[model samples]
Target: MSSPEHDHVATDLLAALAMGDDPAELGLDADARDHLASCPSCTDEVAALRETLELIAAGGGTTLTPPPPSVWEAVKAEIDRPAGAPAAAPAPVTSLASRRRGVPTWLATVAATVALAAGVGLGAWVVQPDEKDDATPQAQVLGEAPLASLDAAAEDRGAAVVRRADDHLVLHVEASDLGGPDGTREVWLINVDGKRMVSLGLLPVGEAGDFDFPERLLDQGYRIVDISFEPDDGNPVHSGTSLARGEIA
Candidate 1:
């Protein structure tokens, strides 16, 4: 088994590769390459990340054309504008108590949602099971839910939960918009009551893939599916930022 430190290094390298970093310049040692070659999960993750990068490159070419010279001139003009009146002195620092008291109810709700997403993302990646369970079975759709975008920037997403004759559960996910290359998108199963939850696994960008689902989740009534952005924080907890979510019927 690989040590935690080794796994962290591998994840870092994978993140760099996903962001189109040059492998030669990354200075990967022999042990790191060996681990990548030997670990199926890491290898699959690298392939998925590379595929996402390619898709992004292909779609981004014409959409991200550089601005014309006139745009740059306009920007320069704004920057050269005359200074206005002197700014007021900075406000004194407030106590934690005062800050909490000043927060609006809606802002507090948003903060709570962000915290929940972060916690779920952090906890999901640590429990990834080995790939030995990949005995592809004829999956039957047990239930599904239409994932709703949690923010205006998020694109449409969807998920389906299927069950095999052997009682194995498989989760199929599809996302219309891609996430940042440095971060990963993870799937979770949350209970309808919103108290209990479990991580399914990382979701591939711009493609659909099936993952091994814990049967116990259904027994425990974890039917709400969520996808959230997770950074490589090396902490096994959610990041409290959800992109999309839905309830599985």
Candidate 2:
């Protein structure tokens, strides 16, 4: 039917296309962009409210709020009710727009305004991390090691950590089967005076990896870490064939 002032300019252009904006270049109302371009159920309710705001932005630490003004006047009185009536209860936001129905009442009022203003759930939500950002800072560990097996009769083993994040540094590494000898495994750091080294690159075929280094390479001594094998013959050096080693401490 479309009339309470064209469903309040199509629920304020579906709340500016549910926040990721662009209510058709913000000019809005060309009859709600010609009924959202001749309505295919308002373009599948603007692609299910932009896939539920991209699953609440891939739920990374969660945050979403907008849905007040009496939940956009209960989404413009559930888009000027008419189809099958009975649904006017939702206002403090949840009750997922009074338990959905034939969809598009501006996508159950912006998915009950971002699932009850982020109290979560309705496709996915995750939360927990707020207590004033719990004073933020994490990832520190600056050193660790274990990677044995420089083959005194091979028993294999691995690990090499060295965190620090957001101030960079990284250098994870991992290994277990120790098995190798035919080509390309590389990853190094050397230079605890054993004649300098750097390579930190190819280990990934599940030998596990992380590498970032250069906080002045652990203050220029590069504390060991090795893991060579390289035999594609393009030789970038360091093929002193070590299979594992560690030192980070």
Indicate which candidate wins on TM-score: 1
Q: Residue-wise lDDT of candidate 1 within 1-249, one digit each (tens)?
A: 344234423333554555665554566555555655676655665665455445545752322222445444433444454577322231121112221332334323322222222221111222222333465655677888777777775456655555644657777777655444568888888888887778888877664677787677777888888887888787667788887887878
Candidate 1 residue 247 Cα shift, in angstroms, is 0.8
TM-scores, each model vs. reference: 0.41, 0.30
* lDDT tens digits, residue span 38-153, model 2: 65644555565566666666875556544446545655666576777665542231011222234445454545544333322223323333344556677788788788887576
Please report, in order, the local distance difference test score of every candidate based on alpha carbons: 0.56, 0.63
lDDT score, candidate 1: 0.56
Among the numbered candidates, top lDDT falls to 2
Residue pairs with backbone atoms closer than 3 Å in model 2 (clashes)? none
TM-score of 1: 0.41
Question: Model 1, poorest ten-residue lDDT window?
Answer: 90-99
